[model samples]
Target: MMRKTLTYFLTLFLVIACSTVPITERKRVNIVDDAEILPASFAQYDTFLKENKLSTNKEKTQEIREIGQRISKSVDRFMRANGMIEEANQYKWEFNLVEDEQMNAWCLPGGKVVFYTGILPVCANEDGIAAVMGHEIAHAFAKHGQERMTSSYGQQLGGVAVALGTSGQDYETQVLWNSIYGISSQVGMLAYSRTHEKEADKLGMVFMIMAGYDPEESIDLWKRMKADSKGGAPPEFLSTHPSHDTRIADLQRYLPVARMNAREYGIDE
Candidate 1:
């Protein structure tokens, strides 16, 4: 009992210690870490790219790079203006378009991004791609990875408590701890993904405007996504993100703010 109690407090402390303190008030946006988390993330993203088939279309690949650079620059400007220049400097953004048909794209910590080729038709143009890129890149800015790690650490401590409370011997306790860590890590991944999607929706709008693309495009893109779904997503709450309906509606609500931000940047929306 004593051991479990102590473990819980320790884990709680780690979560607090590692959590990102937003530059403003009580977390208009929650953030995570790049400096502490990126090394592992980079290696993993690199390996995934190496193992997966890559797009051979020269022009298409070139286009992804160009768009990524333009959007990244815009995000840099916004960050600098907000006194987050130091945070922006931590990014070493790179874009790669892969030849997968999953209609998926993701950005890793420290600005490593990948686009699956299957979604090109959905993207449709430079502006369309900007919508997706802004959202994915926004995940990094929100520090979802660090948030996940911090949350996982807390869960891990809970597992340690279980092991300590129930396991009578050293070997049994060790086994229980390992199992706890494994299961909790998987759960943490799913929860963090939802947070990332929301973060992207917010920050990505900011990026698109800064990059000379209209943030309202995000609403149109999500509308297309729902049409592509043809129906509703099945239990996305358990897997990747919110339901398609939920995402599209949220986009609708935020479009006005995004549009207003673009006007501030002199990008006529």
Candidate 2:
């Protein structure tokens, strides 16, 4: 049994050890799905919506869908022009409005999008809606989910490797895998999650601009977010996002470039 388990572990290790990001050059944001994570993501989103009461703000909720559709569709066009249409169509593309009084929004692995009722006050208008939607859509387009999954697989494989290396050992490997595998495979090692958050901020601004929201608004949004941070949030180092300072700076840096792209591809409103 040990031999069999060891063989299995070795095979898993081989797969993960060999897995790497082939596109060394940072490519334009796009998702490539292999495990059909999108469908599961869509299903999970549906379940959440069914269980939660959606907002009765008929006009506002309709506006969310309108803005989400516009941004999502525009993002698709942008991706296609950039040579990644395949990645954009991976989602079924549904937007929902939840009745919660929290300024929150997210897009799932697929195109499942949700806007919380409370956020409307902050989002303030269609452009603000577009800003938030652009950020969420950017997270999906960048394949953040797959990146996280690949990271996880690496750690599991690493733990199994350590176990196999240990001559006649089980407890140590199991404990180590549980404790460190997740940490070890992180892309940035010391501050991997921050890297992802920053990437999302950059790419999100690109999409917001492409979808007709002024990229400059993103800077203000981050400022608002920074103020919100003081109210309460997970510490900067521990969360998947970096500090608002980093996000604000990145958004500012990307504004000019995003505006140029928008000028080339999008219609002025």
Candidate 3:
């Protein structure tokens, strides 16, 4: 009876928390409140800036900031046009270039963006930078962090449910169940991350196109990334992101749709 009650409430909670992502319209569960998460994200971002070295290359820094501004403006336009005024107002967009050697970049919630210098060579050009920038921004635009937090909570609740359901089992059986649950939940989270990556890829293409970037450049960027990997990347099923080949193919397939959507938005470039 207790197990059934827990299950019932869990389902109810999930249903109430369900929402759809903008543009892609994919259903997501996000129980974490923006009011609760945004301030924390901003504070963390401030701390990160204090701990990290900002790039000294004025040229590269200006370029990143310009691209970020263009893309963010496009995003804001889209949101406001689609009746997302409140959401648009929530973002305090800022971009920075960090003096790091890692080929990495990320966007925190509320649009705090960082670009590592090592990624510039891989970007190869403005279009490539836009590709990476759009992708990272899409993660924040999609509220993936908040969704992930909600997913963690759900996983913990599932652990509780597993414990309750196995209370009558022998110790050995209980141990086995828990081990299985742990492995499965970890894998599930990885899969969830992959989903977010794919969604971000698609959404990024659209945003880049809207910002007058060449969508085809995204495919080329992935190809370059694949070459840089030299075949050392983990298998797709085991990784938190899609493989490079998969991303390249996805961008290729998504290019026409992205361009069409941008045209519809009156962005003809």
Ranking by lDDT: 3, 1, 2
On residues 1-269, what C-alpha lDDT tens digit does candidate 2 reach at each position?
Answer: 77578778656645543432211124322223535687688779989998999988788888888878887888777667767677666667788899988889988887788888877776666766777888787767666666666555555656666666564667876677655655655534436557656666666676677666777777877777778658476666666677778777877777776676567766335
Residue 191 Cα positional deviation in candidate 1, in Å, after optimal superposition: 4.6
C-alpha lDDT of candidate 3 relative to the true structure: 0.93
lDDT of 2 at 68: 82
Report, for every candidate in turn, its global Cα lDDT versus the true structure. Answer: 0.74, 0.69, 0.93
Model 1: CA > 4 A from native: 1-15, 18-33, 161-192, 261-269
Clashing pairs in 1: 32-143
In terms of TM-score, how similar is model 1 to the real structure?
Answer: 0.78
TM-score versus the correct structure, for each prediction: 0.78, 0.77, 0.98
Candidate 2 clashing pairs, residues 3+ apart or interchain: none
lDDT tens digits, residue span 184-269, model 3: 99999999999999999999999999998988989999999999999999989999999999999888888888887787765624
Error of 2 at 112 (Å): 0.8
Runs in model 2 with CA error above 4 Å? 1-35, 166-190, 261-269
Poorest lDDT segment (10 consecutive residues) of candidate 3 = 260-269
